[model samples]
Target: DGVGLMTAADVSAYAHADDGGVEAFVTAGVDVRGWAARPGEGAAGVQDPGTINVVVAVPAALTDAALVNAVATATEAKVQALVEGGYDCSGTPTDAVCVVADAPGPHREAHAFAGPRSLWGARLARAVHRAVLQAVVIADRDGPAVRGQA
Candidate 1:
């Protein structure tokens, strides 16, 4: 048997969503090297890195807590998309995510919450979910083998 590796990203996706005056933009890339497996369910040894990277941007300012929550919210959405795509794993071990938002001005109140149930959080989740889903589809179309999988 042999492991496969693609130097470039296997698939990438982007999506945007807005609720009320809040907006979220998301971009994602996925590359699974047949190492996809549910956490704690895969082989113990380390393998070559295959990553899923997602970046989310928002135009509204948020509190520090909200920013942390946004990262969690985005991750949750990524897992949801992976599950929906029939992938048996939450994500590759090397997966990474980033969330960016405007900084609050001196006189402005930053968003206090960014949970999936919150207005802005919901928008963020939706955008991330859609983008990840799209990436999954692209990977499928390109074939699992090309993604370094069987």
Candidate 2:
């Protein structure tokens, strides 16, 4: 059977009253159709390449630039988790990453307090990493044939 990994996170940040605080909820998952026994090796008995997808919901106050930064931050964190777990993607990952954010509301004021270096980014990375790690753990416990094969 194919393997799949999933995790999620919810975080919030306080901005000035004028900027209005922001709340971010992120849910991310990594799906591995298949994997090889070793990194950079042929598929052999592994499944197809993996893909990452995320869903983010925030108040309308957030800006487009901030949203973009959030997506990038989340993706980088996902890749970092895979690498730290010993999967060498060689900077070319076949994984498909998707991040969706809700439309802005009128009550909140958009604020780009921090880019990818803010507490918001850190929280997002942690959430994505946690989810990916959970998936990896499941894959490892299942069997040795699929172990460490991303």
Whole-model lDDT, model 1: 0.67
- 42: Cα error in model 1, Å: 11
| Candidate 2 Cα outliers beyond 4 Å, as residue runs | 1-49, 58-60, 90-94, 140-150
- Superposition TM-score, candidate 2 onto the true structure: 0.53
Task: Write one digit per residue (lDDT tens) for candidate 1, span 60-133.
Answer: 88999999999899889888887687665577766667777888998767999999998789888888887777
Count of clashes in candidate 2: 5
State the lDDT at 62 in candidate 1.
Answer: 91
Predicted model with the maximum lDDT: 1
* 40-111: candidate 2 lDDT, tens digit per residue: 666367444334343333333446787777777766765676677665531222443344444456765665
TM-score of 1: 0.70
Cα RMSD, model 1: 7.5
Give the range where candidate 1 is weakest over 10 consecutive residues by summed lDDT.
Answer: 1-10
lDDT for 58 in candidate 1 is 72
